[model samples]
Target: MKKLALAVVVTMASSLCAMAASDVTKSPPPAPYEQVSKLVKLPDFLPGMGALFVDPATLPAGPFLAYDHGGKLVSTIYMLPIKDLNPDKRFDNLAAPGGNVDHVDVYYNAGHPGVPEPHVHVVLWHVPAADEARVAK
Candidate 1:
C-alpha cells in the first residue's frame, strides 16, 4: 500500500513537473487573497521554483500556486486543518518516500487568472514527514 501510494505521488509529481508551461503574468492574488500572501511573503517566484500563485476563492488562504521548473503553472498548495475535510475517503497520512500523507483535493478547468483555460488545481494539507524528507533529499 505504501508503495502504491508512493507511486501515485510520483506520478503526480511527474505531472506537476511537466505541466502547462504558460507564462502567467505576475499579479497580486485577488483582494482578500492578498492579505495572506503578504503575511506569508509568498513570493511571485521561489528560488529553484518557477512561480507562485494564489487563487482568490480557495479556502484557508489558498489554492496557492506552485509552478513547474519551466515557469508554467502546475500544482497548488493549501495549508488546511484536518477537521475541515471528510473523514472517509481521505488520505492524510505521514509523507511517503516522495509523497504526501496529506489530503489532496483536485479541480479541473474552473478558470482563474493566469491559468490556462484547461488547468488543474491541487490542494494540499498536513503533509507527512516522509514526503518532506524526499523533497529535502
Candidate 2:
C-alpha cells in the first residue's frame, strides 16, 4: 500500500515537474535504487521498496531507500565526500565505527559513475537527518 501511494505521488510529481519553465532541463531519473542496493547488499529493506529514485550524478552520496517491515520508506543512504569522512576501512567493512551507529549503516560506493569521489553512503534507518535533507521537500 505504501509503495503504491509513493509511486502515485512520484508519478504525479514527475508530471507536474515536467510542466516546468522552458529554461529548466527536465530532471534526470532517480538513482538506480535496485542496482545500488544490490551493489551494497543493503543491511535492511522491504520488497519493492527498493525502487527509490535520486539522481546520483549531482549529489555526493545517497538517500538509499530503506523500508520498514510495512514497505514504507523509513530512511535513506548517501555518500559524504571522501575528503571529509576520511574513512580508513573499506565500504563494506561493517566493523567501522560509523557503519551501524545512530541507526545508520555505511557502505562503499566506489567506481560508480554517479559518484564524483570515491566515498561511502550510509543507510540511515529512521534517522530524521536523511529524511529532513532530501525528502519532505
Candidate 3:
C-alpha cells in the first residue's frame, strides 16, 4: 500500500517538474515575485514557510511555491481548509510544484491573512530537515 502511494507521488512530482521545466533553471522558479504577488497577495517572506506564490484561483489547494532568502526553492505548500477534510472529501493528486521533496510536514493553522479560514498546511520541503532553519524568523 505504501509503495502504491509512493509511486503515485513520484508520478505527480515528475509531471509537475516537467510542466515547470522551462522555469526550473531560475532559482526558486516561481518568479518574478512581483508578478506573482499581483496575482495573489504574497508577503515579502513568510517565516517557516518562506516566500510564497500562488494563484488566487487555486487557493486552499495551492501548490504554493515556497522559496528561501537566497531564492532557493524550498517547499510546496497546500492550505487545506478544515471544513473540507471530511470523509466525503479528498485532496488527491495534490501537486508538489517544487520537485524532489525531502520531507513533508502537516500542521494546523487557525487562520491567517490570504487564508483566513482554519486550515492545515501540508508543506513538502525540498531541503533536508536540518536545512529548514533557513526560513526561521
Q: Is candidate 1 or candidate 2 better by TM-score?
A: 2
Tens digits of per-residue lDDT, candidate 2, 27-81, equal 2223243434434444333342333434344355554444444344455556666
Ordered by TM-score, highest first, the candidates read: 3, 2, 1
lDDT of each: 0.42, 0.46, 0.76
* lDDT tens per residue, model 3, 1-137: 99999999999999987776546423445543322455546667878877777655687568777778887778878899999989999988987656677999999999877778999998998889999998886
Give every collision pair in model 2.
31-54, 61-79, 62-77, 62-78, 62-79, 63-77, 64-77, 78-121
- For every candidate structure, what is the RMSD over all alpha carbons to the true structure, in angstroms? 14.5, 14.3, 8.7
**Number of clashes in every candidate structure?**
4, 8, 0
TM-score of 3: 0.74
Better of 1 and 2 by lDDT: 2
Q: Can you give the lDDT of residue 68 in candidate 1?
A: 42
lDDT (10s digit) by residue, model 1, range 25-50: 22332344333334454544554323
**Strongest candidate by TM-score:** 3
lDDT for model 1, please: 0.42
* Backbone clashes, candidate 3: 0
